[model samples]
Target: MSAPDVFAPARLGPVTLRNRTVKAATFEGRTPEGLVTDGLIDYHLAVARGGIGLTTVAYLSVAPEGRTHREVIVVGEHSLGGLTRLTDAIHETGAAVAAQVGHAGPVANGRSNGVKAIAASSMPSPLSMQMVKAATEADLTRVTKAYVAAARTLVRAGFDVLELHMAHSYLISSFLAPGLNRRKDGWAGSLENRARLGRQVARAVRDEVGDEVAVTAKVSLSDGFKGGVTTADGLAFAQLLEQDGTVDALQMSGGSSLMNPMYLFRGGAPVKEFAASMPLPVRLGMRTPVGRSFMKTYPFEEAYFRDKALQFRAGLSLPLMLLGGINRRDTMEQAMADGFDFVAMGRAVLREPDLVNRLQSERVESGVCIHCNRCMPTIYSGTRCPIIDLELAAHRDPLPQI
Candidate 1:
């Protein structure tokens, strides 16, 4: 088959996106009360209006206890009304909507959540500075049910896609990583055992949604550290998903939200700025060498994950979306040429919500973003480009004299 057009319509399972450029999921930090707020709605509306083919609402927790923090929206009956409104607004802008659903696992903030976090093994949670409990068989069953419930809620909210988040060392991903999953049960040891949770969750969601919506997954291509999910293991798990015929596409990503987040981002880490965003006690700790080492920096490169994603592309027949450091039009077209079905962008679109439209019109200048990654720290407040906010502030009329 010929290479697909980057600017043309593309089908993601039952949903046909206006184009192949997706506004990749980024934690919006807008749902302060664990419910849909106006800020969350407007955050997606801006991206939808900016002409993204699909705008993904990030990190919606499958269960209340599964949240990364208390502020994350839990997909259930309580929040269904607000979620429906949010999706309706986005659809009106001619863009399809996706909700990224997952359990934070060891990555959850136990202190903020008022519940003990669960993981494949008992471990420390840096976010909550608390010990994470090893997930029991009962917990795993509950989580699978939670994923199914969330999938149904998303479909009812008029979402065109259900992006299962099985990456970033979240619940299912921790099970995949040998470093994190020390279980001696059927859910661990061998690759098939370790991969069981992710495959189970995907199949359950697919079964619940059926042909009503596109089902995709943000799959880990690597955990970016030795003893974590290696490239070989990641590729094998992706092929298994293909074999299961569950996900319509896989959005190949890297790094552990638990171990090494910068491995996926590939740019400046902005340690001090990140420190300032934390609480007083944690802020002081982040200044230490130990804290600095945890948030390590990686040099920036365009299409940083392309080489890794190609491995999965070669191994699986299913569609794949290449993510990480996709900023330029040429890069997007090059990805299509290289056999990727779509390109997903996060920071670049955060810098310019209308970037897809600008690239489509051939009016964009490349490298408009500096890749300093300062925007990442702002996820604690509201995810945005601080530079753009500054520029807009400067151009605004001066405040009236006190």
Candidate 2:
């Protein structure tokens, strides 16, 4: 059989995407006040107007304590109006929108959020340099309810999809990682128990939305280090998700936000740039031996995660979205030929939001992104490509709202 066309319409749950290309969720750094701003809307508008099938707004935490920093949006009634406006604007460009909901867990900055980080078990939080407390049963119940609340709010905001962040060593993924989760209670030990929180959240969100929109998950294929979830354990957890019959698709990703993040976006590490972006105290820490260990580097390759994701593709029948270092049309076509349902691009799209349209019209060999990964540090102020002139970005034509 011929490979499925990369530009053709595709169904994700009940939503029909204009094309199979998705602008995967990358923290925009536009919401500095924990609420939507013109910058945030314009960021997604750039991708929508450029012709992405779906553009995901990233890192909407379920609770304030769950936020990675003070500036992260806490999905709730307070932010409803701004979120609604953001989604409506994207729909005007004829592209679907999704919300990436997650709890930062050990990844949360306690100093910034003015709350202690909560994890499956107490551990030293490197972000805040404080001891993270173990989540009690009451805390678990509150978090579950928060997930449901976030789902309802996203649906109300006109989002066509809800992607539960179950990867990157956040609350859910942290619980699933044996090295991070040392709890002896029902939420730990066996793989089934460790996976319970993620399954419950997915089922709850699905029950709340009930086909109103697509329900998907971004799950880790591995934690990218020893003592983390292995490929075997990751696959087993994915099977549990499939058996639950709740999630419509799974976007495969890896690495721990708390530890080895470069495992997910392999390229130049940009260690010096990352240090320079931080405050003086933290800057000094980043230059230390231990700090350098946290910023591990890896070589870049197109479809870097394809070999590992293929294992899930072969083992499970659920729809899968292939991510990590996809910068060319042939790579996307290859994913479709391999039976994947969608292809998600992060840095490549950030480098050129209009690359999808260019790929269709210009027939370019590949995107202009060099995978320098310098853009990684810019997430602190505003997620942007330095190659693009700041003055030009400030003066670009704005899209008309319908």
Candidate 3:
């Protein structure tokens, strides 16, 4: 099956996308002082103009304390001007814009604003393995308020969509992951309890934003970690969200922070290395980067995971946004044919901002993303996007005439 309407416009709640191609969130470390800069504006505008249906701003923290890094954009009253400017720029190209709102949880080093990080439990991060302070009831209240406030701000700033970042072992994800969230409290014991905060945040945001803005969540179907949130848990959560009508769409993803970096962003860890490192119990279905080359070479009858996600959504009637490793037109078309309403592209959009336009015109050549994961490392470096050659060139030789 091929894409149903690859080049056609489709409605997503209130907004319409020019094409099915969405430029997924990729951090461009251009923000300074938690504010958007000219470079950031130029970067997104380039992609928007390139003909993608939508482009999401990466890692916009709902609260100062929730920030992933110092360079991440802060969605607060003070950030309205810059965010509005960004939305207007993207709108100029007829592309919709979504803001990814999240708190980094244990991943938050408080390096951005010097605030202490909070989490569902006091478990240490796998990367740093440093114990994070557990979130008190008051802290949870503040976190919920922050998400509502940020959603309101995004609406005011003219964003067309609000995507709750509930995946990749962030605060919401940590709450969902049983392995990390060992709290005996009401917000931690059962699956229903673990989903409470996310539900509250979504409800608050919806109330504030009203029915005008599209609300969605990027959710991990499984943590891919020992004793973590499983696919069954994810499905139950999805059902709850559907029953409450809290979210308009669900972006299915997998893996956890310490366990599966590749699941957060496609083509990160080499497939073989990731699979080999996994515990034997979960190694049966594992496929790594080394295996990807071979998988592409061999003629396989089975559909990929992206295709299988459609099966997962069988009972639910909500629109689904399929992501992860969707690079080529044929694969995207296959997703659409399989009943997926939308498709998202991350690294490919980063390497070639105009990929959508090239695909639409049947002129797309090889994508620029080398799958090196160099871009991911840049988030911690205070700037994102290592592939911006023009920026690198300018740094190498400043304007001599000036």
- Estimate the TM-score of every prediction: 0.96, 0.95, 0.84
lDDT of 1 at 397: 100
Query: Which model, 1 or 2, shows the larger lDDT?
Result: 2
Candidate 2, position 392, lDDT? 82
Listing every candidate in turn, what is its Cα RMSD in Å to the true structure after a full C-alpha superposition? 1.7, 4.4, 7.0
Model 1 alpha-carbon miss at residue 342, Å: 0.5
lDDT of 3 by residue, 171-215 (tens): 988898888788988998888999998888888888888788999
Candidate 1, 17-94: lDDT as tens digits: 999989899999898888898999999998888889999998899987789888999999999999999999998999
Comparing candidate 2 with candidate 3, which one achieves the higher TM-score?
2
Query: Model 2 segments beyond 4 Å from truth?
Result: 284-290, 390-402
Winner on TM-score (1 vs 3) = 1
Per-residue C-alpha lDDT of model 2 across residues 1-402, encoded as one tens digit per residue = 897788888899999999999999998999989999999999999988988999999989999889998999999999999999999999999999999998999889877789998988998765666688899999999999999999999999999999999988899988999998999899999999999999999999999999999999999888897767888899999999999999999999998877788898898888888878866645654555546677788999999999999999999999999999999989998999999999999988898989899887756968988888889889979999887766587888998999
Worst 10 residues of 2 by lDDT: 281-290
* lDDT at 316, model 2: 94
Model 1 stretches with alpha carbons more than 4 Å out: 281-290, 365-367, 397-402
Clashing pairs in 2: none
lDDT of 1: 0.89
Candidates sorted by TM-score, best first: 1, 2, 3
